[model samples]
Target: MTPSLPDILVGNFLCMAEPPPPESAGEFMAGKVGVVALLSLLAAQEAERGPSARVWENAAIRAVLTDAAEAYGDAFAEAGAGVDTDFTLGALDRANAALRRSLIALHEAVETAGDVVRDHAILRLYGQMADARRLDMPPLPGR
Candidate 1:
């Protein structure tokens, strides 16, 4: 049987000692879903409160997101065929890495930004990501 999401995450984390790579069509799809979900949330928040200075002024963040978006597009094109090739998996890995780096920057901004509401929102998103990571690998095994 296929492993549960958390189990897949944990197993990948333990075995690989890094973020889980998309090893199957389902995993690739799940990664895509996560990307879309975070991007959608960011878009909605920006639309409501306008873009944060940290987000707008950070060229690195912009470039990373743009690159990731393009990579995501490329991955999506191949996704229908089930990420069966090394090329497709490599593209997806690049996209995921870009997105993860961007998130780290945003989380750091959350710590320094003075805007209470925006900071809170960013923190919440960071928390969600952290929770996922926690599930990916426990802090102490058998605890």
Candidate 2:
């Protein structure tokens, strides 16, 4: 079976990691992986669909994606740094957290939208974001 886009993207991100404490590094890597996957997914969607008329019509969705894009960019920029310091890791974590929050808002807006095409497109993007987040989550202890 073919790997999904999020899986492929996360795999690529994890491949480049140099190894660190499992607890801290796992969370950090997961967050970075999710951000990279989400950004790539968003870009691909926009590229395939072009600028959506619906996105411009709905201020909430537009704002959500705009803010998310910015946060994702910030996180992506910091992703290459060595995770040797708590400061660096924390910065990336905050950025990814912001991005995730914005994405949730975007998904909510899209779900309530009346337009079928716009809803479908946004829903797909939202699903990808969710998948990325789930992929990056730390494993349960003793499970």
Highest-scoring model, lDDT: 2
Residue runs of model 2 more than 4 Å from their true location after superposition: 1-64, 67-87, 126-143
In model 2, pairs of residues that clash are none
lDDT of 2 by residue, 13-81 (tens): 675564646675767877766666665665455334322322222233334465444434443223322
- Cα-based lDDT at residue 105, candidate 2: 54
Candidate 1 — which residues are off by over 4 angstroms? 1-90, 107-113, 133-143
Worst 10 residues of 2 by lDDT: 50-59
Worst lDDT window (10 residues) for model 1?
Answer: 76-85
TM-score for candidate 2, please give it. 0.29
- Clashing pairs for model 1 are none
Candidate 1, residues 59-97: lDDT per residue as tens digits? 233443344334244432232222112333334344445
